[model samples]
Target: MLDFINRVLGRESGGSKEIAKERLRLVLVHDRASVSPQLLQALKTDLIQVISKYMDIDEKAMEVTLDSNERQVALVASIPVKSMKRATRTPAVSI
Candidate 1:
């Protein structure tokens, strides 16, 4: 009720509590994904490399994370693309 009232009043409720709870949830999801910080960093680097092959992306703003709910885990990536590379074709060789 208070939360609803706060919403209607154009204010936010559960300020620090909500933030702490969300942080805890993220830690739990990351732990359940069995991904260490080093592993996650490596994955992020590899992803940037592979994605860079086809497009120009903002490395400083890229974000990658393992997210989860009660049912399953998900790998999420937010990459800001500056531009896409033009598609190129190679000549085919006859067997």
Candidate 2:
């Protein structure tokens, strides 16, 4: 990808350096949170199961990542919903 090429060539755009720094920070935050890849996968699976009860989602397109700042770590999910299901016994999630 273009990003790989740019990194290989040591070419940093005006904001790419900051973006790289933020990525490194996120890695450190994940380490501090003790969130392993397996744990993240497990969480993603749980989210899919729970959310699927009320909506049809594109599992292949779903993304779940951890974002952090100086004070807190946040779970960020980008799930593509195909359609919403009718009201059922399962409670709907509120943002």
Candidate 3:
């Protein structure tokens, strides 16, 4: 088989196909888990709120992502702490 020969030859091949396959595999995994990108965002927001109560965290920089592979939904959350500034503007008074 050509695929077998390519493998044995140690030549770089199938890169595009391999990348596409990997993407499809992850998409399928997310689909099966009933986890959507929106859901993942909501989860991330909630998680940040809960965790912030105990420690300082950077909600904007936080990354909560979902990936699917082979009927499995992987929820990945990366929370980092950083300096944040509070808004200075106050509510406008009616003239």
By lDDT, the best candidate is: 2
What are the candidates' C-alpha RMSDs? Answer: 5.0, 6.8, 10.3
Q: Lowest lDDT 10-mer window, candidate 1?
A: 84-93
1-95 in candidate 1: lDDT tens per residue? 88999989989776898889999999999887778999989999999999888888999999999888789899999999999877553436698
Q: Runs in model 2 with CA error above 4 Å?
A: 1-15, 88-95
Residue pairs of candidate 2 with colliding backbone atoms: none
Query: What TM-score, computed on C-alpha atoms, does each candidate reach?
Result: 0.74, 0.71, 0.55
Ranking under TM-score, best-scoring first?
Answer: 1, 2, 3
The total of clashing pairs for model 3 equals 3
Model 3, global lDDT:
0.74
Error of 1 at 40 (Å): 0.7
Clash pairs (backbone) in predicted model 1: none
Off by over 4 Å in 1: 1-14, 88-95
TM-score comparison, 2 vs 3, better candidate: 2
In angstroms, how far off is 8's CA in candidate 3? Answer: 16
lDDT tens readout by residue for model 2, 52-72: 988999999999988887687
Roughly what TM-score does model 2 have, to 2 decimal places? 0.71
